[model samples]
Target chain A: MLVIEGLTKRYATGDLALDDVSLTVPKGQVMALIGPSGAGKSTLIRCVNRLVEPTAGTIRLGETVLTALGDRALRRARRRMGMIFQEYALVERLSVMENVLSGRLGYVGFWRSWFRRFPLADIEEAFRLLARVGLDHMVDKRADALSGGQRQRVGIVRALMQDPELLLVDEPTASLDPKTSRQIMRLIIELAKERGLAAIINIHDVALAQQFAERIVGLHAGRIVFDGPASDLTPEVLTTIYGEEDWSATIRKAEDDDEDEPPAVEAARIAAAD
Target chain B: MDAAAAARAWRPPPLIEAAWLRWAVYGGALLYAVLALGTLEVNWTRAAEGLERGGRFLGAFFPPDFVTHWLEIEEGLLESLTMTVTSTVFGVILSVPVALGASRNLAPMPIYLFCRGLIAVSRTFQEIIIAILFVAMFGFGPLAGMLTLAFSTIGFMGKLLAEDIEDIEKSQAEAVRATGASWFQLLAWGIQPQVLPRFIGLSAYRFDINFRESAVLGLVGAGGIGDTLNSSLDRYEFGTSAAILLIIIAIVMVCEYTSGFIRRAVQ
Candidate 1:
């Protein structure tokens, strides 16, 4: 569970990236944050991990005051949360197994990690996670050599290796193709639910969010404008979240027929532009 | 149409507008050249006679008295190789922390400035000059040459490695941090991978440079082939001097190829 109150972030450049934003993600609940570019969606997600220090506010992850914690305590607190990046930021030069096993870095000693002598249990789990993700054959391959989808799968397995209580996924499907995007979204949602973990997925695709999320939060210009069940997110609400645009037409185009156009294609195009 | 074409046919003017200043600069350079050339003493006859003497001196080195001075050449070459290897190993090892400290992205302000200051001091003096000072302090041997090469290597390797660190993809580091990794873990996983290949390449290249420099360090009694060459020249043993020079050239060529192969392999 994650609770955020009165969170605000003004960067050193004086850009108000997040303003008075507040939200709660219940246990085993999936919340998809949808908004246009520069909508403070990423700022909200990063604030949870204290990756970008909030200018003001309180963030509590199961009674740990993340904002008040010192560096060492913060690192300990961070182990409870897993973050997935848009770029699938696995260490490219490291092998796939190494990147996945790196999830245990918080638990491993420096010398153990420096020599890459991860514990046997961690290695087994990493291999199991790789198998779960269907990348068992490519365990020794360098991360950079993998396809984009494979790399994102590696990212997923890496996050799962953390045994995290909360998942913070930022644009998990932004880089993949339409079919791959749906598959990735399905994988993330299914995995999060199976693990009984609360997740805050920052996404640009409204259709995918509606399909995958139980609750949706829309951010616009550093403020939360909409937060409710996905069914309540009507075309007008989407227009409010995205701005005055041809939403009905796009959504209609997306849903009229699968042969005409897939929701993933239309949503992916809009997401790419964002 | 002709009038319109003429109006649109404008070209940019020359960058240097001050004709007078340009002419003054040219005139001053010309005047300095003429004055310098006029003031120089000419000894054309003496030059001709010296050329004939140089030809005879070179003739003495025709066969390169290899059989006689082979042992001395071997000893000098071995010393030079030893100095190069030892200095490169120590220098590269010492450069790691200095490079980490010098990287603005990684180190704190005070440490960055301190490391930069060290680099500045190392780079300010040439290796031979550093060797001279060390020889005075440590007394004429390979120790002085090794120290000089190591000091110089710190400057070169640290500066380049720091630059490489600064240019690494920041998102990778941020991802590592978000995972709750400790500072050291983040550096090992995120920063090290991005810079290690380049760092290895640079170290090999520095080895080649130190090898060439070590050969000459002995000119100041810092201990290498140059000492033998210097002694040979002083005694007017052109054959021995030529032999030492040839051996040095061969060693340098070998080091060049070895380092090049290493650099390519690492990449």
Candidate 2:
């Protein structure tokens, strides 16, 4: 289980990106953090991994207290948590295989990694993960040469290569098209389940989060305003989270048809439902 | 309707808000230019006589004699080529650490300031000036020229490379760091790949620059083709001097093309 208590982040520039927030994510659970822009969603996940240092908080993953660890200990602890970026931050000039294998950097020695002489087991696992993601054939291609969806797949495989117990995904589908966003979200959800890993995914699309995540945590201006099951995300709850607006179209009903509808028609249907 | 049309008429704001101040600035600049030009006293008659002598000097350069001091020219060219290659190798080897330390995003404040200060000191003087000092200290040879060029190369390469490092995509490096990679691993996987192309291009360009600078270094008793050209001029052997000049131009052209090819290939 990942437990966070009194998590707060105040940037050096005096922006209070996160407030006194406390939450817990048990193992094998997938939670989606939904908030408007500047809602501290990204900061919350980053703080879990200490990518953004918290002003005051304690983050415990399983038995380890993450915030209090020293440099080397922190690095070792970071290996237990994988982070996925919105921009698909794969070393652009490196081949896809190298990018995927970079996750094992903490495990391998410097000389071995420098010479590209990874152990046979690590290479095998990398191949397996790539094959699972359907990117086995493109391992030799440069990361910059791949399309948006393909690059995100490489990013996902790289994170999984760490064999992490927890995944910190930041705006995973923010840059993708609607179909690709749903597909990527589904893949993350499936992978988390298959590995029995807990995940905290920061997403902007409310319907997609409701569809994929078991629980939804709504952040508004650095504080968690609502935390409930996906079914409890009523229009009134969304209004409280995102400020007052007509949110009737945003809250999907249980009987709503979840088909691969075109974006215009989907918008029209939501408008009609409203 | 008249008021609406007037409101729609938009013009860019004046650069200087005060009209009088703007006119005063322009008027002062014009006056300064006129005064500066007036201070330059021209001796037209002396210049006319010198132009005739200059024609005679130019006439002596025709029918360039490449045979009479061919051995000296060959030796100077060889010495310059050796200096260029050796200095570039050593300079680039030393520049990598300095570049890393100078980068604001990579190094701590003290190291960054120290590395930047080193670059500033190296870049303060021209190559010819540094060559003169080194020749005075080391007793006149290609060693002084080589050292001078290498020192100057550090400033050029280190500053440019640091700027490139500072401009790299932060998210890429952050991702690598998040993977629990060591600092060295972060450099190799994240920073190096992003800046490698520019690094190679800068090295090639620096090699070309060092070659040109080495030739000029010879004028200060640091051995290169410029020494041969200087001696030829002292002896009033304009033909031999012109031949050496032609060889220097040819070599510079060759270096330019080769460096260009290497840069494009790497990219």
RMSD of each: 4.8, 4.2
What is residue B79's positional error in candidate 1, in angstroms? 1.3
Worst 10 residues of 1 chain B by lDDT: B10-19
Interface RMSD of each: 0.8, 0.6
lDDT digits (tens) for residues B162-233 of candidate 1? 999999998788888877789999989999999999998999899999988987898999998877788888
Task: For residue B216, give model 2's deviation from the true position in Å.
Answer: 0.6
- Residue B203 in model 1: shift from native, Å? 1.4
Candidate 1 lDDT score relative to the true structure? 0.88
Model 1 chain A weakest 10-residue run by lDDT:
A250-259
Chain A accuracy as TM-score for every candidate: 0.92, 0.93
Model 1, runs deviating above 4 Å: A253-274, B1-61
- In candidate 1, how many clashes are counted? 0
TM-score of chain B of 1: 0.86
